[model samples]
Target: MEIVNSAKEIQEYLQNTRRELHENPEISNKESKTSEIILRELEKFGNFNIRKNVNGNGIIAELIGAKEGKTIALRADMDALQIEEETGVSFESKNKGVMHACGHDNHMTMVLGAAYLLSKRKDELSGKVRFIFQPAEELSPNGGAKGMIKEGALDGVDAIFSMHVWPDLPLGKVGIKEGPLMAASDHFTVTIKGKPSHAAKPNEGIDALVTGAQYVTAVQTIVSRN
Candidate 1:
């Protein structure tokens, strides 16, 4: 696919879309409204095969080119974190205690922007492009990616692409790498089996809280030291 090269020209569209998403953020597994908004906006392009409700509120939109080539996929997550809006901005989250604090709003806006640009030039492209709006990314141990993959989200796709917002980075700056830039994240539970002890007891029983803290501190050594 060729670069659109007019990202700056579409600045206002992107900002308004992102602000709308940020104001009405939805948490994991509850992105029905978000999914609706994405579908509604994607329909404006009027050139794609749109699939909705893929493994619970996931959306897949495809733009097939006139020529024959490989199919590439672009993905975006549509979930917000559990946080209250304290910034007092006008477009702050309407849903109390739920906000797009992790910048998923920007992620969705970017992918939608890409979809718009690609659809505009679908006649000149040489391959297919898939746009995925995934839900439940904030939940671990059973994220929405697993569900989408199980339902064949990546099937028949030659390559995939995704984007994320970095901390305090300049506009249009991109980072590329061959190897994985992030470590694998998974959920873990540590249940220390210790007897209940009194607060002032010197050596009555084991202290689970102190033991957990020590375990955490010990684990930090792996990252802090060589």
Candidate 2:
């Protein structure tokens, strides 16, 4: 039952897991394979009830502590971006035009690592732990968070802990924020209209490219000024 012995051993073990996920990154709302692997791996740890396909490819797992205190949750997002990987790594993304550039693969691995660690120390645990593998964290206006919450992802959870890996924060170091740790995420699209004309034409059509450029610049200042 010992997948790894010490910290170094677990590090290497999780590295391989992360790499496997990174090489096969799946986009939002399309994480069937990723969920399959995660479900398969989590079952090996034992002592938990696992459920899948919650409002998409989300996985919910519950680990009951030996003693009683409060039910806490740990969550991870398992969605990738629609970007092609040019890193040329050996385990580069297999899904072309979709990559784990946002480090969601790392996020999934970290939660799984926590699951393993807590499983080892479950006897000393004073509460329950829920491992939530969520999908579509990047999709705004219709994110998986709302769907999962609607499906009772936090029905009886006292608190939840999740993290994103930051390069500025060195390994073994953690950063904490008070008040608001995240900004409101919103998405919008603007279509600038211009009369079609030949490339060499002058004064024959409005320059939508310039208009859009100005619009982008104007919106960017909202963050700084506010």
Candidate 3:
């Protein structure tokens, strides 16, 4: 992999994008405004095929190289959390009760920065680069990645690359791993039905709250022991 030498330029560009995104935070599956901003930025670079509304506000921009080679994909999610912005930054979120606390704004900015750099050097590149701006990543049941994949986002792609901004790690430093870099998250919900009884009743019906407490404790042990 060829590394770009313009780290300072890239960081500045990413910071501007991140602040803009942070100010206009949008929730999952509702990133119309965010998508428009990304589209506009991508258009300015030139030589990019922009496909909007790929999977509910998701965008895919393709940059074909002069020479034929493998096609690699870079993904960045663009969704905000429901929590209110607590950071007293000057560019705080304008939307009420929504924030980019998970660094998704940073992720989007990084991908867009890379896209900007790569688009300028398209002729020097060997393979195609697909820039994916995905939405609804924080959504449950099904995420934006799954929706994009269902709509053939990964078609003809050889490898996928993604990264998250880690504040814990030192700035300008990158941490990489070969395998099992992150754990796969799996969520399961169990609902128990029981008859409601009066508070004074001793043994009238099965208590659901009691069972739920026990179930939660038991399931936690599974992960703790593993």
TM agreement with the true structure for every prediction:
0.90, 0.86, 0.90
TM-score between candidate 2 and the true structure: 0.86
lDDT for each candidate structure: 0.90, 0.89, 0.89
- Write the residue-wise lDDT of candidate 1 on 89-204 in tens digits: 88899999999998899999999999998898899989899999899998876889989988888999999998788876787698778978745678888789877767788499
**Which tens-of-lDDT digit does each residue in 8-108 have in candidate 2?**
56898799999999988988899999998899889988888888999899999988888989999999999999999999999999999999988899999
Ten consecutive residues with minimal summed lDDT in candidate 3?
1-10
Question: Which order, best to worst by lDDT?
Answer: 1, 2, 3
What range of 10 consecutive residues in model 1 has the weakest lDDT sum?
A: 1-10
Error of 2 at 87 (Å): 0.8
Pairs that collide, model 2: none
Angstrom error of the Cα, residue 161, model 2: value is: 0.5
**Candidate 2: count of backbone clashes, pairs at least 3 residues apart or interchain:** 0
Say which candidate scores most in TM-score: 1
Candidate 2, residue 146: lDDT: 91
Which pairs of residues collide in model 1?
Answer: none
Candidate 1 ranges with C-alpha deviation above 4 Å:
1-5, 196-204
Ordered list by TM-score, greatest first: 1, 3, 2
